[model samples]
Target: MTSPRINSVSIMHYTRPYIELARLEKPTGSLLIFWPFEAWGLTMAAFRTHLPLKYYIPNLLRYLAAAIIIRSCGCTVNDIVDRNIDGNVSRTKKRPLPSGRISVRSALLFLVVQYLVGIVFFVAFLEGLALRTALWQLIPM
Candidate 1:
Protein backbone atom coordinates (compact mmCIF):
# COMPACT_ATOMS: atom_id res chain seq x y z
CA MET A 1 0.00 0.00 0.00
CA THR A 2 1.07 3.58 -0.64
CA SER A 3 2.23 5.68 2.28
CA PRO A 4 -0.38 7.91 3.85
CA ARG A 5 -0.23 11.65 3.45
CA ILE A 6 1.48 13.39 6.33
CA ASN A 7 -0.12 16.64 7.51
CA SER A 8 0.65 19.48 9.86
CA VAL A 9 -1.21 17.91 12.77
CA SER A 10 0.64 14.65 12.29
CA ILE A 11 3.95 16.47 12.29
CA MET A 12 3.05 18.47 15.41
CA HIS A 13 1.98 15.37 17.24
CA TYR A 14 5.26 13.65 16.56
CA THR A 15 7.51 16.65 17.16
CA ARG A 16 8.24 15.73 20.78
CA PRO A 17 8.91 12.12 19.94
CA TYR A 18 11.11 13.14 17.04
CA ILE A 19 13.21 15.31 19.32
CA GLU A 20 13.73 12.32 21.58
CA LEU A 21 14.76 10.17 18.67
CA ALA A 22 17.24 12.85 17.62
CA ARG A 23 18.39 13.16 21.24
CA LEU A 24 17.67 16.88 21.45
CA GLU A 25 15.47 16.29 24.45
CA LYS A 26 18.46 14.87 26.30
CA PRO A 27 20.71 17.57 27.75
CA THR A 28 23.59 15.26 28.67
CA GLY A 29 24.01 13.98 25.14
CA SER A 30 24.15 17.48 23.67
CA LEU A 31 26.45 18.73 26.41
CA LEU A 32 28.83 15.82 25.96
CA ILE A 33 29.15 16.53 22.26
CA PHE A 34 29.15 20.34 22.23
CA TRP A 35 31.14 21.20 25.35
CA PRO A 36 34.48 20.25 23.84
CA PHE A 37 33.90 22.23 20.68
CA GLU A 38 32.84 25.31 22.63
CA ALA A 39 35.75 25.05 25.04
CA TRP A 40 38.33 24.54 22.30
CA GLY A 41 37.02 27.22 19.98
CA LEU A 42 36.74 29.84 22.70
CA THR A 43 40.09 28.93 24.23
CA MET A 44 41.78 28.95 20.84
CA ALA A 45 40.32 32.29 19.95
CA ALA A 46 41.26 33.75 23.34
CA PHE A 47 44.73 32.28 23.17
CA ARG A 48 45.26 33.49 19.62
CA THR A 49 44.52 37.14 20.40
CA HIS A 50 43.71 39.50 23.19
CA LEU A 51 40.50 41.19 22.14
CA PRO A 52 37.45 42.50 23.96
CA LEU A 53 34.86 39.97 25.19
CA LYS A 54 32.01 41.52 23.18
CA TYR A 55 33.83 40.85 19.93
CA TYR A 56 33.31 37.10 20.31
CA ILE A 57 29.60 37.10 21.07
CA PRO A 58 28.53 36.97 17.43
CA ASN A 59 31.05 34.28 16.64
CA LEU A 60 29.80 32.25 19.60
CA LEU A 61 26.24 32.35 18.31
CA ARG A 62 27.28 31.34 14.79
CA TYR A 63 29.21 28.35 16.10
CA LEU A 64 26.40 27.32 18.44
CA ALA A 65 23.87 27.34 15.62
CA ALA A 66 26.24 25.43 13.39
CA ALA A 67 26.83 22.77 16.02
CA ILE A 68 23.13 22.26 16.70
CA ILE A 69 22.28 21.95 13.02
CA ILE A 70 25.18 19.63 12.28
CA ARG A 71 24.30 17.37 15.22
CA SER A 72 20.63 17.28 14.27
CA CYS A 73 21.51 16.37 10.69
CA GLY A 74 23.75 13.58 11.90
CA CYS A 75 20.88 12.20 13.95
CA THR A 76 18.55 12.41 10.96
CA VAL A 77 20.99 10.57 8.73
CA ASN A 78 21.48 7.91 11.40
CA ASP A 79 17.76 7.30 11.67
CA ILE A 80 17.45 6.93 7.92
CA VAL A 81 20.41 4.58 7.64
CA ASP A 82 19.21 2.43 10.50
CA ARG A 83 15.50 2.43 9.81
CA ASN A 84 15.33 -1.33 9.45
CA ILE A 85 17.33 -2.01 12.58
CA ASP A 86 15.44 0.60 14.60
CA GLY A 87 12.15 -0.93 13.58
CA ASN A 88 13.25 -4.30 14.86
CA VAL A 89 15.02 -3.07 17.99
CA SER A 90 12.95 -2.64 21.15
CA ARG A 91 14.68 0.59 22.08
CA THR A 92 14.02 2.53 18.88
CA LYS A 93 10.88 0.84 17.67
CA LYS A 94 8.85 3.95 18.48
CA ARG A 95 11.15 6.41 16.76
CA PRO A 96 9.98 8.66 13.97
CA LEU A 97 11.52 6.66 11.13
CA PRO A 98 10.62 3.23 12.42
CA SER A 99 7.14 4.22 13.53
CA GLY A 100 6.13 5.70 10.16
CA ARG A 101 6.37 9.22 11.52
CA ILE A 102 9.01 10.25 8.99
CA SER A 103 10.18 9.32 5.50
CA VAL A 104 13.65 8.39 4.22
CA ARG A 105 13.68 10.94 1.41
CA SER A 106 12.61 13.59 3.89
CA ALA A 107 15.52 12.65 6.12
CA LEU A 108 18.09 12.92 3.33
CA LEU A 109 16.69 16.23 2.16
CA PHE A 110 16.75 17.57 5.73
CA LEU A 111 20.40 16.53 6.10
CA VAL A 112 21.38 18.19 2.84
CA VAL A 113 19.66 21.41 3.79
CA GLN A 114 21.04 21.41 7.34
CA TYR A 115 24.58 20.76 6.05
CA LEU A 116 24.33 23.56 3.55
CA VAL A 117 23.23 25.87 6.34
CA GLY A 118 26.05 24.66 8.57
CA ILE A 119 28.59 25.38 5.83
CA VAL A 120 27.25 28.88 5.45
CA PHE A 121 27.81 29.51 9.16
CA PHE A 122 31.29 27.99 8.81
CA VAL A 123 32.17 30.70 6.34
CA ALA A 124 31.75 33.14 9.19
CA PHE A 125 34.94 31.73 10.70
CA LEU A 126 36.82 32.50 7.50
CA GLU A 127 35.45 36.03 7.35
CA GLY A 128 38.84 37.73 7.45
CA LEU A 129 40.73 34.91 5.79
CA ALA A 130 41.51 34.22 2.15
CA LEU A 131 39.16 32.31 -0.15
CA ARG A 132 41.63 29.43 -0.60
CA THR A 133 41.53 28.38 3.06
CA ALA A 134 37.73 28.31 3.04
CA LEU A 135 37.65 26.02 0.02
CA TRP A 136 39.47 23.16 1.75
CA GLN A 137 36.92 22.61 4.49
CA LEU A 138 34.18 22.47 1.85
CA ILE A 139 35.72 19.82 -0.41
CA PRO A 140 34.62 17.02 1.92
CA MET A 141 31.12 18.41 2.14
Candidate 2:
Protein backbone atom coordinates (compact mmCIF):
# COMPACT_ATOMS: atom_id res chain seq x y z
CA MET A 1 0.00 0.00 0.00
CA THR A 2 1.14 3.52 -0.77
CA SER A 3 2.05 5.71 2.19
CA PRO A 4 -0.49 8.34 3.18
CA ARG A 5 0.34 12.00 3.49
CA ILE A 6 0.56 13.82 6.84
CA ASN A 7 -2.35 16.19 6.23
CA SER A 8 -4.86 13.40 5.74
CA VAL A 9 -3.47 11.31 8.60
CA SER A 10 -4.41 13.86 11.28
CA ILE A 11 -8.15 13.34 10.77
CA MET A 12 -7.84 9.87 12.29
CA HIS A 13 -4.29 9.03 13.10
CA TYR A 14 -2.95 5.47 13.13
CA THR A 15 0.16 3.41 12.36
CA ARG A 16 2.60 5.51 10.36
CA PRO A 17 6.20 6.56 10.63
CA TYR A 18 5.42 10.22 11.32
CA ILE A 19 2.99 9.39 14.08
CA GLU A 20 5.33 6.66 15.26
CA LEU A 21 8.07 9.25 15.28
CA ALA A 22 5.78 11.35 17.46
CA ARG A 23 5.40 8.35 19.75
CA LEU A 24 9.21 8.29 20.07
CA GLU A 25 9.76 5.11 18.09
CA LYS A 26 10.02 2.65 20.99
CA PRO A 27 12.49 4.78 22.91
CA THR A 28 12.51 4.80 26.72
CA GLY A 29 11.84 8.53 27.05
CA SER A 30 8.22 8.15 28.11
CA LEU A 31 9.02 5.25 30.43
CA LEU A 32 11.82 7.19 32.07
CA ILE A 33 9.47 10.12 32.48
CA PHE A 34 6.70 8.11 34.14
CA TRP A 35 8.42 5.26 36.05
CA PRO A 36 9.99 7.50 38.68
CA PHE A 37 6.60 8.84 39.62
CA GLU A 38 4.97 5.41 39.82
CA ALA A 39 7.92 4.07 41.78
CA TRP A 40 7.83 7.01 44.13
CA GLY A 41 4.16 6.44 44.77
CA LEU A 42 4.53 2.70 45.39
CA THR A 43 7.76 2.94 47.32
CA MET A 44 6.35 5.61 49.58
CA ALA A 45 3.42 3.37 50.27
CA ALA A 46 5.82 0.56 51.11
CA PHE A 47 7.92 2.70 53.42
CA ARG A 48 5.42 5.00 55.04
CA THR A 49 2.33 3.13 56.02
CA HIS A 50 0.15 6.24 56.24
CA LEU A 51 1.28 8.87 53.75
CA PRO A 52 -1.53 8.78 51.23
CA LEU A 53 -0.37 9.53 47.68
CA LYS A 54 -3.66 10.52 46.17
CA TYR A 55 -2.32 14.05 46.11
CA TYR A 56 0.50 13.14 43.76
CA ILE A 57 -1.66 11.39 41.21
CA PRO A 58 -2.35 14.51 39.19
CA ASN A 59 1.33 15.16 38.64
CA LEU A 60 1.79 11.58 37.59
CA LEU A 61 -0.88 12.17 35.03
CA ARG A 62 0.80 15.38 33.96
CA TYR A 63 4.13 13.64 33.60
CA LEU A 64 2.56 11.11 31.32
CA ALA A 65 0.90 13.85 29.30
CA ALA A 66 4.17 15.69 29.01
CA ALA A 67 5.95 12.59 27.86
CA ILE A 68 3.51 12.14 25.02
CA ILE A 69 3.44 15.80 24.04
CA ILE A 70 7.17 16.25 24.28
CA ARG A 71 7.79 13.14 22.26
CA SER A 72 5.43 14.38 19.58
CA CYS A 73 7.08 17.77 19.70
CA GLY A 74 10.43 16.11 19.22
CA CYS A 75 9.03 14.23 16.25
CA THR A 76 7.72 17.38 14.60
CA VAL A 77 10.99 19.17 15.23
CA ASN A 78 12.90 16.28 13.75
CA ASP A 79 10.80 16.31 10.60
CA ILE A 80 11.14 20.07 10.37
CA VAL A 81 14.88 20.03 10.73
CA ASP A 82 15.38 17.03 8.52
CA ARG A 83 12.91 18.05 5.84
CA ASN A 84 15.51 18.53 3.17
CA ILE A 85 17.47 15.51 4.20
CA ASP A 86 14.32 13.42 4.38
CA GLY A 87 13.43 14.57 0.90
CA ASN A 88 16.77 13.32 -0.38
CA VAL A 89 16.62 9.85 1.18
CA SER A 90 14.43 7.32 -0.63
CA ARG A 91 13.06 5.82 2.58
CA THR A 92 11.96 9.26 3.76
CA LYS A 93 11.52 10.85 0.38
CA LYS A 94 7.75 10.65 0.55
CA ARG A 95 7.43 12.19 4.01
CA PRO A 96 5.35 15.31 4.54
CA LEU A 97 8.11 17.82 4.11
CA PRO A 98 9.18 16.46 0.76
CA SER A 99 5.83 15.49 -0.71
CA GLY A 100 4.12 18.80 0.13
CA ARG A 101 1.61 17.01 2.30
CA ILE A 102 2.35 19.41 5.16
CA SER A 103 3.94 22.77 4.83
CA VAL A 104 6.99 24.01 6.73
CA ARG A 105 5.04 26.95 8.12
CA SER A 106 2.33 24.72 9.53
CA ALA A 107 4.90 22.33 10.95
CA LEU A 108 6.64 25.22 12.71
CA LEU A 109 3.40 26.64 14.07
CA PHE A 110 2.43 23.23 15.38
CA LEU A 111 5.77 22.93 17.09
CA VAL A 112 5.33 26.27 18.79
CA VAL A 113 1.94 25.18 20.11
CA GLN A 114 3.44 21.96 21.50
CA TYR A 115 6.23 23.84 23.24
CA LEU A 116 3.64 26.11 24.74
CA VAL A 117 1.98 23.06 26.23
CA GLY A 118 5.35 22.15 27.70
CA ILE A 119 5.49 25.58 29.27
CA VAL A 120 2.06 25.08 30.73
CA PHE A 121 3.10 21.72 32.13
CA PHE A 122 6.18 23.26 33.69
CA VAL A 123 4.23 26.11 35.18
CA ALA A 124 1.60 23.78 36.52
CA PHE A 125 4.29 21.58 38.03
CA LEU A 126 5.79 24.57 39.80
CA GLU A 127 2.47 25.56 41.35
CA GLY A 128 1.08 22.08 41.98
CA LEU A 129 1.10 20.36 45.38
CA ALA A 130 1.33 17.11 43.44
CA LEU A 131 4.95 18.05 42.72
CA ARG A 132 5.95 18.28 46.40
CA THR A 133 4.88 14.71 47.08
CA ALA A 134 6.87 13.27 44.19
CA LEU A 135 10.09 14.91 45.34
CA TRP A 136 10.21 13.00 48.61
CA GLN A 137 11.52 9.76 47.16
CA LEU A 138 11.11 6.86 49.52
CA ILE A 139 13.93 4.59 50.72
CA PRO A 140 15.72 2.59 48.03
CA MET A 141 14.50 -0.93 47.51
Candidate 3:
Protein backbone atom coordinates (compact mmCIF):
# COMPACT_ATOMS: atom_id res chain seq x y z
CA MET A 1 0.00 0.00 0.00
CA THR A 2 2.73 2.47 0.96
CA SER A 3 4.83 1.58 -2.07
CA PRO A 4 1.96 2.07 -4.52
CA ARG A 5 1.06 5.41 -3.00
CA ILE A 6 4.66 6.60 -3.21
CA ASN A 7 4.86 5.47 -6.86
CA SER A 8 1.72 7.34 -7.79
CA VAL A 9 3.01 10.51 -6.18
CA SER A 10 6.30 10.09 -8.00
CA ILE A 11 4.50 9.69 -11.30
CA MET A 12 2.56 12.89 -10.75
CA HIS A 13 5.76 14.72 -9.89
CA TYR A 14 7.40 13.51 -13.09
CA THR A 15 4.45 14.61 -15.22
CA ARG A 16 4.30 18.12 -13.76
CA PRO A 17 6.84 19.54 -16.18
CA TYR A 18 5.03 18.17 -19.21
CA ILE A 19 1.72 19.43 -17.94
CA GLU A 20 3.13 22.91 -17.55
CA LEU A 21 4.73 22.67 -20.95
CA ALA A 22 1.29 22.02 -22.40
CA ARG A 23 -0.27 24.84 -20.33
CA LEU A 24 -2.86 22.49 -18.86
CA GLU A 25 -2.83 24.52 -15.64
CA LYS A 26 -4.38 27.46 -17.51
CA PRO A 27 -7.57 26.41 -19.32
CA THR A 28 -8.62 29.85 -20.56
CA GLY A 29 -6.78 29.31 -23.80
CA SER A 30 -8.68 26.09 -24.44
CA LEU A 31 -12.01 27.68 -23.69
CA LEU A 32 -11.27 30.68 -25.84
CA ILE A 33 -10.45 28.44 -28.74
CA PHE A 34 -13.49 26.26 -28.08
CA TRP A 35 -16.35 28.68 -27.54
CA PRO A 36 -16.18 30.96 -30.55
CA PHE A 37 -15.73 28.27 -33.17
CA GLU A 38 -17.03 24.97 -31.87
CA ALA A 39 -19.42 25.46 -28.98
CA TRP A 40 -21.53 28.29 -30.38
CA GLY A 41 -21.61 26.84 -33.85
CA LEU A 42 -22.70 23.46 -32.59
CA THR A 43 -25.26 24.95 -30.27
CA MET A 44 -26.82 27.03 -33.00
CA ALA A 45 -26.85 24.13 -35.44
CA ALA A 46 -28.44 21.83 -32.90
CA PHE A 47 -31.04 24.46 -32.06
CA ARG A 48 -31.86 25.10 -35.71
CA THR A 49 -32.00 21.43 -36.69
CA HIS A 50 -33.68 20.23 -33.50
CA LEU A 51 -30.87 17.73 -33.06
CA PRO A 52 -31.42 15.20 -30.28
CA LEU A 53 -29.69 15.61 -26.92
CA LYS A 54 -27.80 12.36 -27.43
CA TYR A 55 -26.03 13.65 -30.56
CA TYR A 56 -25.54 17.24 -29.39
CA ILE A 57 -24.05 16.27 -26.03
CA PRO A 58 -21.58 13.78 -27.41
CA ASN A 59 -20.45 16.14 -30.18
CA LEU A 60 -19.95 18.91 -27.66
CA LEU A 61 -17.78 16.62 -25.57
CA ARG A 62 -15.68 15.71 -28.59
CA TYR A 63 -15.22 19.37 -29.53
CA LEU A 64 -14.17 20.14 -25.97
CA ALA A 65 -11.55 17.41 -26.10
CA ALA A 66 -10.31 18.68 -29.45
CA ALA A 67 -10.04 22.22 -28.15
CA ILE A 68 -7.90 21.07 -25.22
CA ILE A 69 -5.61 18.99 -27.40
CA ILE A 70 -5.26 21.74 -30.00
CA ARG A 71 -4.45 24.35 -27.41
CA SER A 72 -1.88 22.06 -25.81
CA CYS A 73 -0.20 21.54 -29.15
CA GLY A 74 -0.12 25.27 -29.87
CA CYS A 75 1.42 26.04 -26.46
CA THR A 76 4.07 23.35 -26.86
CA VAL A 77 5.04 24.74 -30.26
CA ASN A 78 5.21 28.29 -28.93
CA ASP A 79 7.40 27.25 -26.01
CA ILE A 80 9.71 25.25 -28.21
CA VAL A 81 10.07 28.04 -30.75
CA ASP A 82 10.56 30.77 -28.17
CA ARG A 83 12.71 28.82 -25.74
CA ASN A 84 15.72 31.06 -26.13
CA ILE A 85 13.75 34.29 -26.04
CA ASP A 86 11.64 32.99 -23.15
CA GLY A 87 14.75 32.35 -21.09
CA ASN A 88 15.62 36.01 -21.34
CA VAL A 89 12.12 37.34 -20.68
CA SER A 90 10.85 38.18 -17.20
CA ARG A 91 7.35 36.76 -17.51
CA THR A 92 8.28 33.58 -19.40
CA LYS A 93 11.63 32.85 -17.87
CA LYS A 94 10.28 30.14 -15.60
CA ARG A 95 8.46 28.21 -18.32
CA PRO A 96 9.34 24.55 -18.71
CA LEU A 97 11.73 24.94 -21.66
CA PRO A 98 13.27 28.18 -20.42
CA SER A 99 13.62 26.92 -16.88
CA GLY A 100 15.32 23.74 -18.09
CA ARG A 101 12.56 21.58 -16.66
CA ILE A 102 12.03 20.00 -20.09
CA SER A 103 14.43 19.43 -22.96
CA VAL A 104 13.70 20.60 -26.51
CA ARG A 105 13.93 17.04 -27.78
CA SER A 106 11.46 15.87 -25.17
CA ALA A 107 9.12 18.76 -25.95
CA LEU A 108 9.24 17.92 -29.64
CA LEU A 109 8.33 14.34 -28.89
CA PHE A 110 5.45 15.53 -26.75
CA LEU A 111 4.25 17.81 -29.54
CA VAL A 112 4.31 14.97 -32.06
CA VAL A 113 2.34 12.84 -29.67
CA GLN A 114 -0.27 15.59 -29.29
CA TYR A 115 -0.65 15.94 -33.06
CA LEU A 116 -0.98 12.19 -33.45
CA VAL A 117 -3.69 12.05 -30.81
CA GLY A 118 -5.54 14.95 -32.45
CA ILE A 119 -5.38 13.28 -35.85
CA VAL A 120 -6.59 9.97 -34.49
CA PHE A 121 -9.40 11.72 -32.66
CA PHE A 122 -10.64 13.66 -35.70
CA VAL A 123 -10.36 10.62 -37.95
CA ALA A 124 -12.20 8.38 -35.54
CA PHE A 125 -15.08 10.70 -34.70
CA LEU A 126 -15.52 12.58 -37.99
CA GLU A 127 -16.14 11.55 -41.59
CA GLY A 128 -15.79 12.78 -45.20
CA LEU A 129 -15.56 16.57 -45.49
CA ALA A 130 -16.01 16.98 -41.78
CA LEU A 131 -12.99 14.79 -41.19
CA ARG A 132 -10.92 16.64 -43.76
CA THR A 133 -11.90 20.02 -42.36
CA ALA A 134 -11.13 18.93 -38.80
CA LEU A 135 -7.78 17.50 -39.82
CA TRP A 136 -7.00 20.68 -41.73
CA GLN A 137 -7.61 22.71 -38.59
CA LEU A 138 -4.85 20.74 -36.90
CA ILE A 139 -2.38 22.28 -39.34
CA PRO A 140 -1.44 25.80 -38.43
CA MET A 141 -2.29 28.38 -41.07
Candidate 4:
Protein backbone atom coordinates (compact mmCIF):
# COMPACT_ATOMS: atom_id res chain seq x y z
CA MET A 1 0.00 0.00 0.00
CA THR A 2 1.17 3.52 -0.72
CA SER A 3 2.07 5.72 2.21
CA PRO A 4 -0.04 8.78 3.04
CA ARG A 5 2.60 11.25 1.85
CA ILE A 6 2.89 9.53 -1.53
CA ASN A 7 -0.90 9.35 -1.84
CA SER A 8 -1.31 13.03 -1.08
CA VAL A 9 1.46 13.97 -3.50
CA SER A 10 -0.12 11.93 -6.27
CA ILE A 11 -3.51 13.47 -5.58
CA MET A 12 -2.11 16.99 -5.68
CA HIS A 13 -0.13 16.31 -8.86
CA TYR A 14 -3.24 15.03 -10.60
CA THR A 15 -5.75 17.56 -9.31
CA ARG A 16 -3.86 20.78 -8.72
CA PRO A 17 -3.68 21.88 -12.34
CA TYR A 18 -7.46 21.76 -12.63
CA ILE A 19 -7.82 24.46 -9.98
CA GLU A 20 -5.89 26.86 -12.20
CA LEU A 21 -7.68 25.51 -15.26
CA ALA A 22 -11.05 26.36 -13.68
CA ARG A 23 -9.90 29.82 -12.52
CA LEU A 24 -10.89 29.05 -8.92
CA GLU A 25 -7.49 30.33 -7.80
CA LYS A 26 -8.40 33.82 -9.04
CA PRO A 27 -12.08 34.42 -8.29
CA THR A 28 -12.37 38.14 -8.83
CA GLY A 29 -13.41 37.57 -12.44
CA SER A 30 -16.06 35.05 -11.43
CA LEU A 31 -17.31 37.27 -8.62
CA LEU A 32 -17.48 40.27 -10.91
CA ILE A 33 -19.68 38.33 -13.30
CA PHE A 34 -21.61 36.50 -10.58
CA TRP A 35 -22.53 39.31 -8.20
CA PRO A 36 -24.03 41.75 -10.66
CA PHE A 37 -26.15 39.15 -12.41
CA GLU A 38 -27.15 37.61 -9.11
CA ALA A 39 -28.10 40.99 -7.70
CA TRP A 40 -30.19 41.84 -10.74
CA GLY A 41 -31.94 38.47 -10.76
CA LEU A 42 -32.60 38.59 -7.02
CA THR A 43 -33.92 42.11 -7.31
CA MET A 44 -36.26 41.14 -10.10
CA ALA A 45 -37.34 38.01 -8.29
CA ALA A 46 -38.02 40.02 -5.13
CA PHE A 47 -40.37 42.27 -7.08
CA ARG A 48 -42.81 39.39 -7.24
CA THR A 49 -45.41 39.54 -4.49
CA HIS A 50 -45.36 37.19 -1.49
CA LEU A 51 -41.89 35.74 -2.08
CA PRO A 52 -41.06 34.61 1.43
CA LEU A 53 -37.47 34.35 2.63
CA LYS A 54 -37.87 30.60 2.76
CA TYR A 55 -38.52 30.55 -0.99
CA TYR A 56 -36.06 33.27 -1.90
CA ILE A 57 -33.11 32.00 0.10
CA PRO A 58 -32.81 28.59 -1.54
CA ASN A 59 -33.27 30.04 -4.98
CA LEU A 60 -30.64 32.64 -4.19
CA LEU A 61 -28.16 29.91 -3.28
CA ARG A 62 -28.93 27.99 -6.47
CA TYR A 63 -28.42 31.12 -8.50
CA LEU A 64 -25.08 31.64 -6.83
CA ALA A 65 -24.04 28.10 -7.73
CA ALA A 66 -25.17 28.59 -11.31
CA ALA A 67 -23.20 31.80 -11.56
CA ILE A 68 -20.04 30.07 -10.40
CA ILE A 69 -20.55 27.22 -12.88
CA ILE A 70 -21.19 29.60 -15.75
CA ARG A 71 -18.16 31.68 -14.88
CA SER A 72 -15.98 28.57 -14.78
CA CYS A 73 -17.33 27.46 -18.12
CA GLY A 74 -16.56 30.87 -19.56
CA CYS A 75 -13.04 30.70 -18.20
CA THR A 76 -12.53 27.23 -19.64
CA VAL A 77 -13.77 28.23 -23.06
CA ASN A 78 -11.59 31.33 -23.02
CA ASP A 79 -8.57 29.24 -22.15
CA ILE A 80 -9.32 26.81 -24.95
CA VAL A 81 -9.78 29.49 -27.54
CA ASP A 82 -6.91 31.60 -26.36
CA ARG A 83 -4.38 28.89 -25.60
CA ASN A 84 -1.97 29.95 -28.32
CA ILE A 85 -2.51 33.63 -27.70
CA ASP A 86 -2.12 33.17 -23.99
CA GLY A 87 1.18 31.46 -24.51
CA ASN A 88 2.52 34.60 -26.10
CA VAL A 89 1.40 36.85 -23.26
CA SER A 90 3.58 37.21 -20.17
CA ARG A 91 0.68 37.26 -17.70
CA THR A 92 -1.10 34.19 -19.08
CA LYS A 93 1.83 32.06 -20.23
CA LYS A 94 1.81 29.96 -17.10
CA ARG A 95 -1.87 29.04 -17.24
CA PRO A 96 -2.74 25.36 -17.45
CA LEU A 97 -3.28 25.29 -21.18
CA PRO A 98 -0.41 27.51 -22.20
CA SER A 99 2.05 26.21 -19.65
CA GLY A 100 1.84 22.55 -20.74
CA ARG A 101 0.27 21.61 -17.43
CA ILE A 102 -2.75 20.17 -19.24
CA SER A 103 -3.32 19.08 -22.82
CA VAL A 104 -5.85 20.81 -25.08
CA ARG A 105 -7.94 17.65 -25.45
CA SER A 106 -7.96 17.11 -21.70
CA ALA A 107 -8.95 20.71 -21.11
CA LEU A 108 -11.82 20.35 -23.57
CA LEU A 109 -12.96 17.16 -21.88
CA PHE A 110 -12.87 18.92 -18.53
CA LEU A 111 -14.97 21.72 -19.98
CA VAL A 112 -17.56 19.27 -21.25
CA VAL A 113 -17.73 17.61 -17.86
CA GLN A 114 -18.16 20.95 -16.17
CA TYR A 115 -21.07 21.79 -18.50
CA LEU A 116 -22.74 18.44 -17.90
CA VAL A 117 -22.37 18.79 -14.14
CA GLY A 118 -23.76 22.32 -14.32
CA ILE A 119 -26.71 21.08 -16.33
CA VAL A 120 -27.34 18.32 -13.80
CA PHE A 121 -27.27 20.79 -10.92
CA PHE A 122 -29.61 23.16 -12.79
CA VAL A 123 -32.07 20.40 -13.63
CA ALA A 124 -32.06 19.13 -10.07
CA PHE A 125 -32.66 22.58 -8.62
CA LEU A 126 -35.46 23.29 -11.08
CA GLU A 127 -37.01 19.90 -10.50
CA GLY A 128 -36.91 20.45 -6.77
CA LEU A 129 -38.85 23.68 -7.29
CA ALA A 130 -41.15 22.12 -9.91
CA LEU A 131 -40.21 24.78 -12.42
CA ARG A 132 -41.36 23.96 -15.96
CA THR A 133 -42.20 25.38 -19.33
CA ALA A 134 -45.21 24.09 -21.21
CA LEU A 135 -44.47 22.09 -24.37
CA TRP A 136 -46.82 24.26 -26.39
CA GLN A 137 -44.83 27.41 -25.66
CA LEU A 138 -41.63 25.76 -26.88
CA ILE A 139 -43.05 24.66 -30.23
CA PRO A 140 -42.68 26.90 -33.25
CA MET A 141 -45.74 27.35 -35.35
Better of 2 and 4 by lDDT: 4
Window of ten residues with lowest summed lDDT in model 2? 132-141
User: Could you arrange the candidates by TM-score from highest to lowest?
Assistant: 3, 4, 1, 2
Error of 1 at 18 (Å): 5.5
Candidate 2: residue 67 lDDT (0-100): 58
lDDT of 1 by residue, 1-141 (tens): 999999998886867655755567755645655568764667687768975668766666655655565566667767878899999999889888798866777666666766676567666565555334433433333
Residues 15-105, candidate 3: write the lDDT tens digits: 9989999899999999998999999999999999999999999999999999998888889989999999999999999998999988999
lDDT scores of the candidates, listed in order? 0.66, 0.63, 0.91, 0.76
TM-score of each: 0.68, 0.57, 0.91, 0.78
Query: Alpha-carbon error at 56 in model 3, in Å?
Result: 0.7
**Winner of 2 and 4 under TM-score:** 4
Q: Better model by lDDT, 1 or 3?
A: 3
Candidate no. 1 TM-score: 0.68
> How far in Å is the alpha carbon of 44 misplaced in model 3?
0.4
**Regions more than 4 Å wrong, model 4:** 1-6, 127-141
**Residue 24 in model 3: lDDT:** 97
| Candidate 4 lDDT tens digits, 1-141 | 965566778888888888888888788876786578775768677877667888888877777776677777778888899999999999999999999999999998998888777767766776533333211211223
Please tell me which model should have the higher lDDT, number 1 or number 2. 1
